[model samples]
Target: MNELKDKVALITGGTKGIGLGIAQALLSQGIHVAITSRSAKAAEETAKQLNSSATKARAIGVKADVRDFESQQNAVRLVLSEFKQLDFVIANAGLGHFASIEELTLEQWQDTIDTNLTGAFYTIKASVEALKKSKGYYISISSLAGANFFAKGAAYNASKFGLTGFTQAVMLDLRQHGVKVSTIMPGSVSTHFNGNEPDSSDDWKIQIEDIGELVVDLLKMNPRALPSKVEVRPTMPPSK
Candidate 1:
């Protein structure tokens, strides 16, 4: 882990929940982190929290709409300006709008794809050059929905499934350049995703911190070993 100290990472949609969780874990490893949110204020607030005196690592906040190529490019530039070299880029920004195919509006479906799928594309395109120079890692926070579709999850499922395939294709393209790419698909995480509050009863679900720890482990893995896709689930959960 000490080998990773002073490295840098940029996380998209990093203000709250899983993104923030990953930021915290990276900071703990002495990695400089730049976390982005659509809101400048929220991004700055969380960056400050992560860089508190106790942990006291370099952290920056940037406002970027991953849905836009220009915005994502600006974010990549900001991270380069702050940290010089980027060792990891996490395409963790996402959204979910659940509705049956007939019930889903065109706008809702478009927003989900734009945010959850195209956003990852924009982010990777913006960062790939820098990642190549650093021989870094690219990890996308895909979800179980990427593989399992539900009755009311047409928009969300389609976006994630596309994202899953997109990341895999990217992995094959970037690996020759010494950059590693992977996607993490998590199930039933105790997070604020989809605006759902996590209560005590949600403890049986995977914790956001658990995902963070998994990311750290991935980063620490031997460079020759790559777990290109990971599906995480709670060890014990209420039966279906």
Candidate 2:
């Protein structure tokens, strides 16, 4: 879209899956995109794969662990150094752990919460000033698990639920500053998230590209309108 042309966008955990999809979508629209991964190799590889002369410029990828505040901050800095401005930040890096409450270890709970919730906070806090300067957007890739509880998902559910609340409050707090914030909660995406293998057989699951398309739509929307929350699901999930 014309609105996204020349804008700079950053996506965390964007080496593959949903994050990569979003990066690709933005790049196709002429947006300058930056992506972060835990590994420098993965980041470089993904950027190479997404780059094309047609996209105007290749996406930039940086090594960043979202759980580390300094790392998150550095990722934003790298983007700014390369692009000269940061217009959007997508806090899409997250993890999930599934276990019944009685069986869940404290370590497992902490890992989930730290990566999924606290990591998002770190990424946003690092980018807040840049976003405010550009009057940009902050999008969180949450999950339906944030609202719907399930067996063996106590830790994952808690992290997501807390994230949902956090996203809403941040949206309200940032709106006054002309920075838009929104959360996208998707269910059962066909991606390698949380170590799940994605195969062609998993056609019933939500496609990663769909989430990418949604983010592009959000960027194209008028500044007067803000869809602070969006919940998406596969129209026809396979029957058990």
**If scored against the real structure, what TM-score would every candidate get?**
0.97, 0.96
**Clash count per candidate:** 0, 0
Off by more than 4 A, model 2: 52-54
What would the per-residue lDDT of candidate 1 be over residues 101-129, giving only the tens digit for each residue? Answer: 78899999899999999999999999999
C-alpha local distance difference test of each model? 0.92, 0.90
| TM-score for candidate 2, residues paired by index | 0.96
Best by lDDT: 1
> Against the true structure, candidate 1 has what lDDT?
0.92
What ranges in model 1 sit over 4 Å off?
53-56
Residue pairs with colliding backbones in model 2 are none
Candidate 2 weakest ten by summed lDDT: 52-61
Task: Indicate the worst ten consecutive residues by lDDT in candidate 1.
Answer: 49-58
